[model samples]
Target: MAADGTFSPVPTGEKSPEGAIGPRSNTGQKGGAGALIDYCTVVLPESSIEDHGVTWLPNLIGQLFGTNGAIVVGSIRNKPWQFYSQSAVLLDREGEMVGRVGLGGNGSTICVSLSGAGCRWVTRWDNVAKAVERWRGKLSRVDVAYDDYDGECLDVHALRERAAQGDFASGGRPPMHRFLSDEGHGTGCTLYVGAKGHKELCVYEKGKQLGLKTSPWVRAEVRMYGKHTALPLDVLTRPLDYLRGAYSVLQEIITGFCTRIRTTRKAVEATGTAMVEWMHRQVGPAINLLREAFGASWADFAEVHIAREGHPGRFRGVAKGDRLAQLMREELCPS
Candidate 1:
């Protein structure tokens, strides 16, 4: 257990496998795009989900990491609102739960915990669009809950009013707005209904304020919750289907949230590279499967890179740092 009393399932002193992807450090300065390739190689092969029979959440959680990759936490009740821990609650070396994953009730909720470093590499709008494509047809609603502690003074009431006006809805479509609490004031809490019937988007503030004098950085809790009646509890038990669906939804939420938040150019590029590299590393069979399933392609990946670099403005050219340039070169010209 950690000092905070939460349990981390990761074992102590266990190093990441020889070629694992993602940052080994908290800051994500070391790995670059190579980490993404390693990560995809690691998770892509185990992407298959099978019926493992009914099991408890705790028992199912233990199988999600290491060689097995992500799997569904099965429930016997076959309830419409199935709960999952998301990919964020990975175990540490001591098997302690490092980082946090939200647990709540909704029609169907998929949670993903992004490390400080992982957040830089994994979240983007294009990536989200691709991830959610498979489940898009079945989705009835989508909600996002993001934690904001960047010291931006946000007026909750104004946001709610805007939501009421459909300002948040895309394409001039109006969304049903509701406040989570009776307090009319906003602490950066608001929900927007998806233009698609039954779809919803939620953005909420997380973490706690220390005192008037010591305000901690705010953590955002952005969730993508929706209603998909087509996915009954029994079908969710199938690991591959569950993972595919969860991965899509989780990526969508993360991408949407990151796009809204402020980030550095370097960080965005690194993340875009990681996202693309991971897609490229998918197994031939899996690639074909994904293509057949969602019409995904390498062509779409260009958007991720472009979004990260930003659209051309008055500035004609942006210089790249030595490290970043090297990473980009390597990705462009794989050794």
Candidate 2:
């Protein structure tokens, strides 16, 4: 709350679209720089107007952010958020809003959110973290985003394929996912894993998002909710590690592939990520019913029917040899 027994406020950024770890890795090696702390929301520990003054809100921000650039640009008359009801926008050297504060009366919880640019501009995270530590602030949410330039790691298509193959599944089942494309509208594409309020991940074309029609830059982001999990301030210092910990697939950075190993695989039917969906809808039920009715003899009839059929109608024409092998190669894309 403000010193005058009023309130303070945050910037107006879009909240996560409603609808929407594997391990603890200490590998601070290469590529951590690629991850960006695009968004952050922290709730200040219990506070009162008596301890600090009406100006205490800004003063607290100044101490945590190490600057007096907080312009009390908001009040109850112009609340930035619906809950906090009052706010102040924290400006940087460039007068850009690096962060915003949400405050109400004494004992009312205060909230603060830093934007993508704000996260990059804040260089004193470690020092300010100490101040927050003393106050015992709690992180409500944080988004760790990584840009895979030209899909150096993996693109949206790869993510969709992998999810279909259950590569992103940490628990036994893969999370729900949806793919949205501009369909040549020039807006770009996006892949969403899981949903809101749950562990969610969004992988999209960053360059295309910026209007680069042909740019291949893909960005992957993981949003963490501290409502149930304990979020440490170290997430700010090592966002990349946290991101990798979100999905085991993300940790497998594709550096490239060796031609020798690529050509040495055994000759088997070319099945890709789509194989799972097809099997579930087509093969699984039929086999289950056959087994239920015929018992051990189900295989005799089912396998005989499948073998006699030779190949499914869809694969009747994309027969073996180089043409069929090419289909397999495409599915094993390095990207």
TM-score on alpha carbons, each prediction: 0.29, 0.59
lDDT score for residue 167 of model 1: 59
Q: lDDT per residue, candidate 2, 1-335, as tens digits? A: 12232111111131211210111222332222325566878777545423444345656666665444533233324564637657777655544556677777534777777766455444445555566676777677778776655466667887889988888876567788899988987567899987776468899876566544566667788887665654677665556556666766765552221111121121112233334446877789878998999998998997667656233333322234464456556644534
Q: Name the candidate that leads on lDDT.
A: 2
Least accurate stretch of 10 residues (summed lDDT) in model 2?
A: 14-23
Q: Lowest lDDT 10-mer window, candidate 1?
A: 37-46
